[model samples]
Target chain A: MAEAAESPGDPVTASSRPLFAGLSDISISQDIPVEGEITIPMRSRIREFDSSTLNESVQNTVMRDLKAVGKKFMHVLYPRKSNTLLRDWDLWGPLILCVTLALMLQRGSVDSEKDGGPQFAEVFVIVWFGAVTITLNSKLLGGNISFFQSLCVLGYCILPLTVAMLVCRLVLLAEPGPINFMVRLFVVIVMFAWSIVASTAFLADSQPPNRKALAVYPVFLFYFVISWMILTFTP
Target chain B: MAAVDDLQFEEFGDVAASLAANPDATMVSIEDPGETPKHQPGPPRGSGREEDDELLGNDDSDKTELLAGQKKSSPFWTFEYYQTFFDVDTYQVFDRIKGSLLPIPGKNFVRLYVRSNPDLYGPFWICATLVFAIAISGNLSNFLIHLGQKTYHYVPEFRKVSIAATVIYAYAWLVPLALWGFLMWRNSKVMNIVSYSFLEIVCVYGYSLFIYIPTAILWIIPQKAVRWILVMIALGVSGSVLAMTFWPAVREDNRRVALATIVTIVLLHMLLSVGCLAYFFDAPEMDHLPTTTVAPNQTAKSS
Candidate 1:
């Protein structure tokens, strides 16, 4: 009787079949040994699956490659995936409202004049502050964070920023010459680069330094440039 | 040839596909300590090569939840994740500039110098000399001519010339903006630092001009408040200049950072404008002041 179709006595191999063959449907049993997690899902559901119908070897290769890519990109921006106060909305909302209010007050000052108003130093401060305030709001919105939490994040991130500014000021003071401008430029550049990397690091460590979040001088520069160009050139 | 065919790595295959993609890679025995994790090998039961290969290679196409069967998580910013959110070329130019600025030996020298002194002077001196030379060469003649003119309060001839020059200077500034933008696009990623740096310098230098300009000219309201307001505006602009020019680490674009900047600038401008109005125009003084305030009842109320 055709040798009983080669049926074996092995308990787990009653009707032995290759794990994968010409079958149209595939069920993947993924068990991460290191993590001790077992996940069984359809092969077609996997975003990284090679194709609608792929062989075992091909599937293995795709998963490995995907893991590597995800790890690299993920680490590039936030190494630790930690939370911070900068994600708080309560703190930012009022802070933003205050800034807006301040600007409105200034606008009133301008309206007092028919030909235009006098220049005020505090106006520029408000401008710089605007950049920081807006950025905080944007992060909170994107991060789905509480307004108050974002304020805390800002508090932490601003530390490195303050230091960089102080250092730049000190450098400029020592020179007070034409070269001072160059030094100032250099300081700003260095501070920006440092902040980007530092923030990324801070994001990784759950206990990010509140003092560091204040290092936003670089973002100011970006706004200053873009806005200045638009204001000056758009006409 | 047979080996390549036998190792027929389906384009969208597993980790093995990664290995297959790199034909030059020497395949070590799977038993090698480094080749495989130290954990016990999985049961050699199923023909999983194809299944695993498909999983690994099809990552991009796989819209499946990173958490199996779970909903995908959204990131902090939706716009930031958009494919074209960043202009890549602009960043590349920025990178190129950074690369040129940081040569190995030169970088080492600067680092060591800074480390020893913690404040750079040698480079500052060199840069100063160049700036001084340029400034003097470009403006000395104008300086002398201005000094020669006895009617300094408001020379009609000079004012006309200056108005024309102001227009030209404004035009000249555009060149830097465009060139910088182009450069940024070339190395869009690097644009992060270069663009910010350029903007900072402009803020600083632009405000510095006020130091030389007559404060009285800014008097649009009453005299007392107008001057004070002007001074404040100048200072605020100067601060922005200083912050932008001096701080390099401020290049990132987080949501909070962007918002802070916008609010700060708008408020600053508003404050300055208000002060100017309060100081420059003496509408209330019309009835009180014998010389000005043509309108009636204005001065009595202001006093």
Candidate 2:
């Protein structure tokens, strides 16, 4: 971004030399009042950073968003506590987990199709409604966390259990027996507990110690339900 | 920060005693603790704020209170009007929830904890938490019971959300409305009956249900004996709170009326738990070989 900002004129010159060159040297107007709101077009308003983001192709934008989503998922998988983790909140990670889980557990879609697992619509509704309920509980309990911030945290924390489900499917590929069942049980239990720890690590400081359980109980149930689903998956 | 004691918990104690003295500060003066037994049961914090103001002499707290006073004085339709309903501190909420959990006789739950400042924060939230708790646990128990059945299909029960919303909202809201109306009518007929404001009634009902938030989640246990036992324990604890709190309000009336009112409270309490248990949590259909085969899986986790 610093390079892009510094080399702003380079992009124009590389594409095609400006006819007069000085026309490109013109700066944005500073005479406009800076203190108040104005209805500037979005392109003009963000013209300064245009070279970095605006000139990117569709694939580049998607990749950037995906990279952000991947970083959050990685944080959940590793289960670290950092203030910067709380600063950025997005639903993309949760949405990806829901899709991934639904695809992995595709024994049957919700009576809709034969080939697909649980439909995306079903997973989407369950995840969002659970997240909304959990967020509402935290806010009502007088936690200082914002709604979507908690939602995104809870959503990303599902990463471990989703990963457990993936591992369970691979274990199921082996012959069904006592050994496989024990392996599945062990993986599901560990990841289920990990999911809880990751979520509360992110959310714990926001709630008071006494009332933290009230906010966290809903989070527990959210992952508990998914854990049960994973634990019960059959070959 | 603690100029005297190094103990950090002294702060919670200091704040707790001062908590009861806060809402009606003007009414409770130096001599007031000798008069009102209910508000002064704890060590007198009547002059604690004065000491703090003298030592810290921070106008920041005063400025915030002044801003709050301005907010309370505003008309009802503005944004602060609604926000102020949920403006209670975390300590006060915890104290109220504690009082609801441990219903000590001779001290009214509403009067000791709620009547002074009765906000809608607890009532609104406890109800919301119970809604999701039941919905999620209900679905989970269904899956867990059928865990090892090879042919059994898993479908997420989306309908439980709506059903939970309806049942929980109706009980939390409609019952309070009816009970408040009954109290109002009885107050007019009987001379000087203790009449609870509608919001206070709603707040008590709301906090009383906090036990069920944990209980509902535990209902995911597939064993019938454990589920019923949990329901009964939750019912007994929260039920005592409501019954004892309301006992004073109806003790003056005739025995039949009081008995009937108490019965209705107990009966409705039973109906909510048992009805929800029956409706949401299904009994195990069959205990077969597959379940036996996977029984060790459950045992393995426990071990």
lDDT of 1 by residue, B67-90 (tens): 111111225365433211111122
lDDT of 1 at A125: 48
lDDT of 2: 0.69
Summarize candidate 1's per-residue lDDT along A3-119 as a digit string, tens digits.
222222222333355533311111212212312322334433564475443556776766765554344333333435543223322233234433432332232333333312212
Chain A TM-scores of all predicted models: 0.33, 0.73
Poorest lDDT segment (10 consecutive residues) of candidate 2 chain A: A26-35
Clashing pairs in 2: A106-A117
lDDT value for model 1: 0.32
Per-residue lDDT for A223 in model 1? 32
The CA lDDT at B250 in model 2 is 82
Q: What is the lDDT of residue B88 in candidate 2?
A: 57
Name model 2 segments beyond 4 Å from true.
A1-52, A79-83, A102-106, A109-122, A136-147, A175-181, A205-217, A233-235, B1-98, B117-165, B188-193, B210-236, B252-256, B280-303
lDDT (Cα, tens digit) per residue for candidate 2, span A85-142: 5898988788888788867765643544432224456566777887897787678656
Tell me the lDDT of model 1 at B39.
19
